[model samples]
Target: MATFEATAEAAAKNLESGRTLRELSDLFTPMAIRVAITLRIAQKIDAGRLTAEALAADTATDADVLERVLLHLVTIGVLTRNDRGEFGLTRIGEDMLVENGKAANPPWLDLNTVAGRAELAFTRLLDVARTGEVAYSAQYGTSFWDDLTRDPSSGTDFDVVMAGGMERRIREIAEAYDWGALGSVVDVGGGNGTLLTGLLHAHPRLRGTVLDRHAEPALRTFEDVGLGERATATTGSFLDPLPPGAGGYILSRIQSDWNDADVRTILSHCLEAARPHGKVIVVDEFATEEGVRCDSEDDLRMLVYYGGKERTMEQVRALAADVGLSVESLRKAADWTVMELAPAEN
Candidate 1:
């Protein structure tokens, strides 16, 4: 009787914790929404497919199951069902539609895309926890980059998603530094040339090179943006030797995807490329103090996706020290933490 009373009190406390019981236990809604997005239900409804049968036909889904899912969407205010059994989108549902060639949500949420397929590895989080292995490889036979490379379109899609999402941050990084003074810079592992293009656009006198495994995307972006004359793309890897004697080497948001040893190697290459007083500018979002809810969640996502974990500022400093580099300046440019490194004085 006493144990029963204790369990009852614990349950009561849980109810009083302000998170709705449904919110805590309900996984169906999110999965259903993702299905709706993958099936383009919102797009179809906007295009006048108002009945479950029609939507099922359009999406090649089971009519009965799709009808039930539609009803749940209505109950959850994502859709509305009328007396005639026709369905329509509510304001919430309308937001799911693409507008002006931009998705209402990030492209990573669409199950049809590479990022979407990658995030499905989150379902294997338990396996990851037990074995300390990456959830991505367990879900798919290959690592994230390998999967992307196997599908050429997947690589381009992933790059577009990343470049599109970081548009604002790219602009901030461009404005935060004086690229003109550097005269020439190399963006190490710079995918799609998005960051380098922004810098060149912001500083007319600046010339830049992009060193990446694939050169076509970066070269195409440079041409599309009319900066081809000033910018060049070289096919290479940051893990190997980088183009030498650049005024500065920019490593933006790349370190978080690697382990400490690999990160040290990458930084060492950049330092070598930036020798004789050139700077190695590191821009990344470092982890903050633990117990911050958002950072914890993001760290988990990184771990599951790439076997990478966000580093704290002190951890970053220690890695830099290992590579014979010292932090010359650290500041925030918009939402990014920008750290400039120079070789330690002998």
Candidate 2:
């Protein structure tokens, strides 16, 4: 008994020291995803029978290395390996690999993609937390937003991958809203207008305006989503200004990207654009320190990729009130919270 207890204590210490099993899992998740995408393993098995050898040939990867990765992924439940040595997609894997319909998701989760490659810098999250700044600024000497603006394509992955990945979540939020009575909706910083496009298509009576810094491709996306007639694309920065006279303003996935100071600026813009009785809908991380947490992997991604932080309901309420907005109520969903607030009273 004494020897067993001593061994247990030592194992626990090792588990918590350096990189624990948990930390290693966190570290390799994005990389393993990237490896899968790079090798097109999912694509190979889409129609069902593909030997491990075929995957290496099709993707031009080392057969031995590819086989090891797939085997490891299977061990972790990412992919399934059968007795015949054939590998195939799991339900979650299928959702991520499907090219169309509800199965379509963010390729950003795939590390081999261009955006995923750059996002791997999440290892530098230590620098971000230490200085309250982005490591990108340290290594690249520019802000994440600035880089996207300077190079238009960097933001495209987010528009397609992240937005598409979150489409199901957005659908939940859109359906939850009191759409029975509403006029105009403004999607602030709505990348490629996926949410707006989804919302407008669902609530046809509602006219939508997609406000973004890079409004060019978003305009094209309107036509692509077939909401071109009901929706319009416009240039407006929530951090700077918003379109005048909106019935409700939605800052989905926006506020958490900024610190409190910037959130105030954006909220103030919402207030200015809001009509009397207009509600400001803030869709973001609700700063919960408890159950059903934000994606820890994605949390670290923001800290490393763009130097953003997730916030809680309390943090959001304080920031909104400071910007002359009052919280009316809180609405909860599976992974996000919607703070229904209005311009401050008196």
Report the number of the highest-TM-score candidate: 1
lDDT of 2 by residue, 149-258 (tens): 76666567656665756768877777777642568878888888888877776677888888887888778988887775678888767777677787888888887677
- Candidate 2: minimum summed lDDT over ten consecutive residues — where? 99-108
Residue 37 alpha-carbon offset, candidate 1, angstroms = 0.7
Q: Give the TM-score of candidate 2.
A: 0.69
Best-fitting candidate, scored by lDDT:
1
lDDT of each: 0.82, 0.72
Candidate 1 lDDT tens digits, 170-227: 7888777777899899988788999899899889999999888788899999989888
- Model 1 alpha-carbon drift over 4 Å, by segment: 1-22, 99-101, 165-168, 289-294
Worst ten-residue run, lDDT, model 1?
Answer: 288-297
**Model 1: residue 71 alpha-carbon error in angstroms:** 2.3
* Structural similarity to truth (TM-score) of each candidate: 0.86, 0.69
